[model samples]
Target: MMRRFEDARILMYSHDTFGLGHLRRCRTIAHSLVEDYRGLNILIISGATIAGAFDYRARVDFVKIPSVIKLRNGEYTSLEKHIDLHETLKMRQSIIRHTAETFEPDIFIVDKEPMGLRGEVEETLAYLKTRGTTLVLGLREVMDAPHLLDAEWKRNDVMRKIGQYYDRIWVYGPPDFYDPLVGLDVPPAVRSKMDFVGFLQRSVSHDHGDDHRPSGDYILVTTGGGGDGAELIHDVIHAYQQDPTLTHRALMVLGPYMPAKQRRKLVRKGSKIPYIEVIEFDNRMEELIAGAKAVVAMGGYNTYCEILSFDKPALIVPRIVPRQEQLIRAQRAAELGLIDMLLPEESADPLRFAAALKALPSRNPPSVNAKGLRLEGLPNISRIVGDWIDGRGGKEPLRVIKR
Candidate 1:
């Protein structure tokens, strides 16, 4: 068992190289923790290029790691320097370890990846294990399908690592809909450390007033990161072109990482439709989401949480390559009646896309009342982490406070 320390000095590691999911998740959890425990101090370690864009609370701080790019060939390379992929990954891992050692955090919460920054976290995890510091693994509710996850989990030795090092395995999604650890071959002893923490969502106080001139009820098109979103964006544009009566305006936000040539092509195509507006990137995405009548989006974890929290009707087009996590999330959300998902084959069909878009209601459907979704666990996560430091364990009841 990991040794417990008293009080709060927490370090959260989020390896968000391209998109906002990991960073956003860390931020949400940190915000909840600080609000629940006024004495807590949080230091977020993220690799996002746009980390500065977010507004954080007083007790929270950030460390920006060098950015990396996901190439068309499904490979990743460092963006800031011309280094071998192996070398880049090694360098990043070294920095992550150094930061952890120097900071000496009482509790370390690692998001998704077990090894961290290409296994750099292994060094820190080893050091923390020797020092008897608490270590927790934070996982999203849905990872991928059983078979794929089984293969990847074994290959990465994630189960072994979790069983060996982690004191707690906190799942950010409910167990009823999906258990992230299923099929991972976790032993019963290690499984005892698992806790389902419910979905972590950004809480926006009051709707940011809908100021932008409605734009005649247009469909908002967004790909979390346009790296793999080219096909989806093209399909949406084609769908719009095929049906002249579709009548709705189209606002496409090409993610910052999309290739320039591809973006230019989309811009030229969008020009053909007087009602379609193509923007390279916009910081005010939440504003755009709020202004839209319906949303057409990729099924990234962060996007799923936003759609649920905003309570908007959405058509999720998930990416199935590199990882099947998005597809699983979209399918699960659809099954729960939280949102609509377009199958990979149907995503390209103009009629099918249009029909799905047209079928979406303007509001979210009512949800089933359940213990898991009470959002009672958010504050509890904070309390548990704090109490864990103070030598507490097992399940504890959570209290909710309105801000």
Candidate 2:
């Protein structure tokens, strides 16, 4: 009974509390969905300060809510000092509910946060559930240290709420790669709703990399969103200062959120190093990563995907504070021989970091056996969505390359 289902609307929510990771991930999926289904329209409700900075497709649009920022100590506050956190949360909740009512999305997808930043989206989820709109929860391949996540959820009864509201739970990675809920006491029902869609792959539209890419092979160092990235950048610069023989030209991107003072110091110091180049921010990260000989990054989910998609050798310096999501991911990926990892303390050692950078360019890129690595999230999502819309109910995922 599959119909010709040509037209549909999908609404996505991204509570970008910290960096651009949530918003970027949503945008990537939104673009892919629209590209696959010509008649589909996607509306993303985002809390990113620079939500308007990136481009969107013809049918892809976004609604910007008041931005909220997360501090290193794991607390959230209004992005604007003048606005009270309580009032901002109220405004965000109201805006989300109103948008959901107006959009009437066939599918409602919430990224990461189960209850949406202090349970702001709880009411919307209930409303959508009553309306019979397909409610989906999208999660990163790695969440956080299990105990930390478990305690946080237990305090709010988030696991129970997820089961009650969501019809499906999409973990954006292959099941074998990692289980986001491994240590949690997830009920059988919630477990059954889980779908391991593999990693979301990245692609560059065109090769505009000539401008930034080095003539000879170089390492591209990037910290997604750059709020907690100053430490990594400082380490890299110090490594170069310590090792005069490290000749590989390094291109570093200071993400938009990095403090102005830190950025200036890094720029001034990096300028003295003939082989190092520092840029403020570039939306074309895929291009830079693709063109590089290797990558040095803080290993955010998006950066991890980019590393695999581009098949570049990478050195991941995963952060351990606030949340251990990056550390956990880096550890797993390193264990699987997908990437090399260094702890923050280890990476801070100028000599150790310099040696890693020197070896990075010549190291082998990611290569695995048939059951090794897969990037099938986008295609599978499109297929399942198409099936749902056409009344075909395609629950199974499409296969990836055998290599």
Candidate 3:
């Protein structure tokens, strides 16, 4: 843990179970750190199979472990490798432990999962704690509902690990919008270490460069990773199919993880509609979003950030089963006038989607009220990390600022 300020090393763990949120969030943080602090090295340990597809900045790198996906039954399975869940988790556990010991980073930031998948990061957390590493846990603005989150955390013994191993907990969103730990019976001990660092603002550069921009006005529809988004995609496409008189052109990015056959089926369906275009994936999604007349998406953390970053008017169709995190976020944001959302039942009806689509052109942009929301989380995170480097962290609670 002892190191020259200029030589400080940061290691982040992102358990990318089913989506790109964790990896993208960590990458933004890692890039911000190294960019702000000269010679600060950051290494991310991720389970993202598409890790190489991203463009990482200088001084930021990653170690990709075997991937896993969370199933609808609340169990994890190997993403691609033939091994069973137990073997996959064991392999991941070993890789994490070895990386922590060998990397010996001054600051260790664990993304979302306190103990990682199946507690794979337990050994690493324990190891780094004994070494006096500056340990932190990065969280999204909203986890699931309070009762669900409390029960799950309790079952997983998350609070204890948080109390024992982490020096600080950074919630990457504004408290004014949502208090992530509220109603979870977060002990005073853990609460004291919590900081609402505001939302991590994504760069507009990722929105799109000239080359990737769409040639014509279009409504951009995307499901973060496209695995569980089949229903949403289907509804949207069906809406377009049912409403031939729809004026706006739509470009759909079927997430890479969507079953190939399903993607092909969607592609075929889209081919019949002149107004609809379908693609597999785009690393530069922000570009597409930036150029869109309006945005339609699932309510993943990263997607929300991108939508807010561009201040686009968005129609959020969030998933409800398996996890309610996205639905919770979408609902809250809608209530706050940051975006609009269709209920599960409503999104399932093509007629309703068609109705929503027809009104998209007249909808107000999120920027109308997004001005009051905090989007400086990336810079604030860098400041907080700098404070830690200077031994000045934990001196003050990051208060909620009402914008």
Candidate 4:
């Protein structure tokens, strides 16, 4: 199809308080949308401190908001020590509203958090709703444990707000994988708006511009954003140390948010292992994943998508604290034979982890095990956006998938 809608605008929100997962997912979606349509421009509002480290496509850009960090205990505070949390939230809310007012987007896509971090985007959502914008709520394939998720949402009237503001809710996974809103009091009105769009596929950039990208056979170990990744990284290193027979070359990306002391400690330890290579961070993770023989990760949403996108053998060591989202995803994928999983406790057993790591490369890839797997989210989303812009949208009824 020829490029159309030269003046169309899209605004995306990624309340990136904890990890790189949110920003990376939004970036991939934004890039895919622009490629699908000509003359379309997308602006992402991100709270990640390293949002600008990423490369954006021609028509996609981002606005960085004041950073607020979400601690492991589920409390929020300003990333800057001197700034008050309330003050930071106020600034973020103000900037988000101002950007929406100026950008005047035809569509507003909010990632995960309905009201955004601490309801910072509530005003923006309301303003956009008044302007007749197509408001969308994008959710990961799996959310936290249903009970935990329910309590969190119950604290605020999140379900009500989502029903009121969003015209559509896109689950970035297939219907068979998981339902993000399971065990919640979802009204029929809100349930009808859901579209199970499958997983967002990833691809290496056209330019192999990064000289640091790995070459040859190696297991890629990553903790997305490295905020809470120290344990996983340590476990991997311990596995290498425990068994000298595990000689597969490993490249570990410590992630950007990892504390410097822990990063330094891990780097120092991993360096002593002949087959282990540690890099602080790399923005072009897709390229590295593509080059790897297998993958070891904490099973964040973005990494899982990339593992499937690249069809690499994967071992998922999912985090269970603060949120069980990753653990849920890992367990489900394991059940489907898409990937292998180890609890944090299991991974700490160096011998057990080393054995898992050694066996990783030969394990069958996701494509072979999960014939029903899908990675059509990007294209489907593009089509949906086009339909909405081209006068073809109303809540076209879709099956309200249940757990």
Collision pairs in model 2: 173-198
**TM accuracy, model 3:** 0.94
Provide the lowest-lDDT 10-residue window in model 4. Answer: 394-403
lDDT of 2 by residue, 242-291 (tens): 99998899999989988899999999999999999999888878878989
Model 4 stretches astray by more than 4 angstroms: 208-212, 392-403
lDDT of 1 by residue, 189-270 (tens): 6777778876665555333364543446777888976777788888888877887766667788888768789988998998
Q: Tens digit of lDDT per residue, candidate 4, span 1-403?
A: 4358859999999999999999999999998888888878999999999999998999899999999998989898899989999999999999999999999998899999999999999999999888788898999989899999999898998998999999989899998888998888899999888898889999988855546566778999999999999999999999888898999999999999999999999999988999999999998999899999999999999999999999999999999998999999999999999999999999999999999998899999999987867798888888778777776334442333332
Best by lDDT: 4
In the predicted model 1, the residue pairs found to clash are none
Top-TM-score candidate index = 4
Q: Estimate each model's TM-score.
A: 0.87, 0.95, 0.94, 0.97
**Runs in model 2 lying further than 4 Å from the true structure:** 1-6, 207-215, 368-371, 392-403
In model 3, the worst 10-residue window by lDDT is 394-403
> If both were scored by lDDT, which would come out higher, candidate 2 or candidate 4?
4
lDDT comparing candidate 2 with the true structure: 0.88
